[model samples]
Target: MHGLVNRCIEVFLRSTYGNALWQEVAAETDVHPDGFLTWGNSPDGVTRSIVIASARRLDKSAGELLEDVGAWLSRQEQIRRLLRFGGASFEEFVESLRELPGRVKLVIPDLELPGFAVLSDARGRYRIIAESHQSGLMRVMAGMLRGMADDYGSLVIISVARDRIEIDVVLPDYSGRRRFELSPMQVRP
Candidate 1:
């Protein structure tokens, strides 16, 4: 890889997503496409086309990794992090997400929930369908029941569906599923 093309992509990304978001995406995926501002053939046979080829290779494992997840509650935790998020509040959560880069529609039932659960980084929003090779969707139905305490009122998660999770009450929907890490202590931003 030549510094020239790399610089080109850097410029484009800095301008588009802004330094903050672009840098975050770059950190996670390790690809900086800012040079895509122009299409230049590399001196070697390996041109900008190399990026596309590599992406294809990456697609194989990444595709199946998310699909093989079998737990219904895990899926719900995934969705919870995506839709409203599991951090301090729903708003701070969505502000940090990169959108689902592809189109994959998984079935999600709108239902009541018990409490909040944590979501995972993989398969949260990157794939098309949340495929389960085993059984557990019913467990989600039961876990949601756990949120039903006699005297507490708060957003409790009941089940998981991919990056979306169900809570006791409906939250105003945010656009894309953003990944979040939960901590015991709140850090000042």
Candidate 2:
């Protein structure tokens, strides 16, 4: 698995739960307490072990924990910027999901994101199939969808199954959308 994936989990666990809990989970899983390198690769087993141990220690299901991680990830500036590049509105963003894997690949050649197939039914209903070697990714995607909905000021109901996610955009523009700038400012020395 890509180290960035594991590193996100590690950051989420530590920031949300505290460094002590992260260290405990790391110890239980035999992972280094300092955590994964953002650009390095680790065995998939290491990620699974960390997730299992953390979930067990927290007394939460792995799906629930990963969902939280996804939501947290959405708030990160870099991730939010990357996702916001999808479109200007919530609906447009969801439509752009079909191209997400390729977009991500362009930035990180070696990173493998889940392949997403988006199906639109009624006007505001979307069904997304997320395929990856890792388990519980659908839940994470579901959480991300929810977070993005809020970010775009849309009201949505999201449901997750083993490999699929359903999103019902109750209100496409329910509130004020968060601000997003296309370009970052250059810092002068």
Candidate 3:
């Protein structure tokens, strides 16, 4: 896993809990307490262990922590830049999610990022299938999608199927009629 993922977990812990608690979790989980450069990599198991240990310390479910971490990541400037590069609108960005891991590869060629397959099932609804050789990472994808929706000032309801690692994205008014446009594009006749 990329150090960016671990760094985010560390940041989430420090922000949500505290520096001391982060230290405790890192010690208990056997994760390094420092030196997590975003461009570096770590064993996927270590990252997962840190997250699980953090949840136990905070008395929250792993899913809740993952979702909060995803949301917090969206708020980070580095990740915001990447998501902005994906598209200008919530719908467009979500549609381009499948390409994110590929883009991540540009920076870390050997990184094994999670893969996504986004498909439009019907109007206002989409399905995203996320797969990773490592388990439990799909929860992060589900939360990331939710965070992306928040970034666009949009509301989305997400349902996850853990067995298949599929996330169903439902937009209540995704008919494009309520879309917030900055300005109308001009057409030449």
Candidate 4:
């Protein structure tokens, strides 16, 4: 597994729970207390162990915990900026998901992101099929979709299954959206 993925989990644990909880999780998983390097690689077993131990200590299901991690990730400025680059509206963003893996690869050549296949039904409902070696990726994607919906000021109902996610956009533009600029320097204080 890529270190970035594990590092995200570590950051999520530390920021959401606390450094102490993260330390306990690291010790329980036999991982180094300093956590993963952003550009390094670790065995997939290490990632699984950390998730399992963290979930057990936190008294939450792994899926639930991973989902929270996804939400936390979306709130990060760098990640949010990357996701916001998908589109201006939620619907457009959903449509752009097919290119997400490639986009991410362009930035991090060695990072292994999940492949997303976006499908739409006659009723305008969208389904995202996530393919990855890691488990619970779909759940994380569900959390990210929910967070992005909020960022786009849209109302959506999202459901997660083992390998796919369903999204029902109730209102594409339900409220005011956060400002986004093509260049950070364009922002005014």
Go through the candidates in order and give each one's C-alpha lDDT: 0.33, 0.87, 0.70, 0.87
Which portions of model 1 miss their true places by more than 4 Å? 31-189
lDDT, candidate 4, residue 99?
90
Writing each residue's lDDT as its tens digit, candidate 3 over 1-189 gives 777778878888898778999889878877667737566777778887888888887888887788678777777655666676787767787778778888878977877676767788675577776554433566676677777776666667777665233434455334442233333342112
lDDT of 2 by residue, 1-189 (tens): 888889889999988999999989888888888998668898988888898889889999989988988899888878988999999999999999999889989989899887878999899899998656444777787778889999999999999888888888999989999888787553111
Candidate 2, TM-score vs. the true structure? 0.93
Ten-residue region with minimum lDDT total, candidate 4: 130-139
Off by over 4 Å in 4: 132-135
Query: How does residue 41 of candidate 4 score in lDDT?
Result: 88
> Number of clashing pairs, model 2?
0
- Selected candidate, larger TM-score, 2 vs 4: 4
Write down the TM-score of every candidate. Answer: 0.18, 0.93, 0.79, 0.94
Candidate 3 wrong stretches, greater than 4 Å: 35-40, 132-135, 163-189
**Candidate 1 residue lDDT tens string, 145-187:** 2222111223333444544433333332323333335541442
> Which of 1 and 4 is the better model by lDDT?
4
Q: Which window of ten consecutive residues has the lowest lDDT sum in model 3?
A: 180-189
How good is model 4 by TM-score?
A: 0.94
Count of clashes, each model: 24, 0, 0, 0
